[model samples]
Target: MPAMSRSTEAIVRIDSAAKTVFAYLDDHRHLGAHMSASSWMMLGSKMDYEFDAGEARLVGSKFGFHGKILGIAMAAEQVVAIRTSPRLKVWETIGAPNLWVIGRYRMGFEIVPETRWSRLRVFIEYDLPKAAPARWLGLIFANAYARWCTGRMAKDAARYFETAGGQAVPSIG
Candidate 1:
């Protein structure tokens, strides 16, 4: 069915300015490491692979991640898109049929600069199958997963700004 609920407007302000946020997010290795590590554990994905190496300059770049869901083997393909520096970034899934069962996974990010810091805005939109059980499970997991992912991204953004280097962002339990 249609999405039961969507938390598309989560915001977090990081200590770094807008430029730093832009640089960090645009840096493929930085973004990939932070997200890959977090997603691997949370999704129980076996291997997170980056086909881009370090040259992820434009959108449409593709990457794959291997994992299992409920003991069923799975792999996910992600395609980069809509690169808006320090403001907006979007990615769509190109792999994983099981994920398609629920809906398409889309990620959007925006940053607003304040006096000394920047507010990071993230939006996640997924179209769900028009089925009761799937919709129910989507709702249940959506909220919990969004919260988990949001906190992790914010923490990682902060560290990325402060350190000016890539570091593992701790998951917030």
Candidate 2:
């Protein structure tokens, strides 16, 4: 069935050992550090308190960040839905001056036991306001952002998994 919303999808295969990818995301604190140039730096709530280990499974869990796009103030919130091994999924709602966009993002990792090579898939669904200007702007730049974020994450994940003791898989295009 059609998504009934705008979307962006990307995938990257990683070579790593069992639980490596899951462990990487399980460390929310360290994950942000690995992200370079993330506009939404304050991804989750509780920077001031202790990390809730169960947060990984909290559906409807939300967090927001204030940022500027093209120098204009914008706000975004993401909700956690799935965060188990082999699959990490979340959804985001973002609002700007006259635009509101919804994004459903997911990443999948498949670990190869002996070779330690893993396959990864990343997908994003971007739903924009049903207005002309909003649709226009989104069509112009949303995919670019998705592509960049996906590529960057893939590269960073590669470096992270390898250096953190997982096997290094040749990056796939």
The prediction achieving the highest TM-score against the true structure is 1
Candidate 2, 34-110: lDDT as tens digits: 23243452232212212234443355555444444445444444455555554554534433323323233333233
* Residue 133's lDDT in candidate 1: 64
**Residue 14 lDDT (model 1):** 77
Q: What TM-score does model 1 achieve against the real structure?
A: 0.69
Off by over 4 Å in 2: 1-4, 28-57, 92-115, 131-134, 167-173
Report the Cα lDDT for residue 43, model 2: 36
TM-score of every candidate: 0.69, 0.62
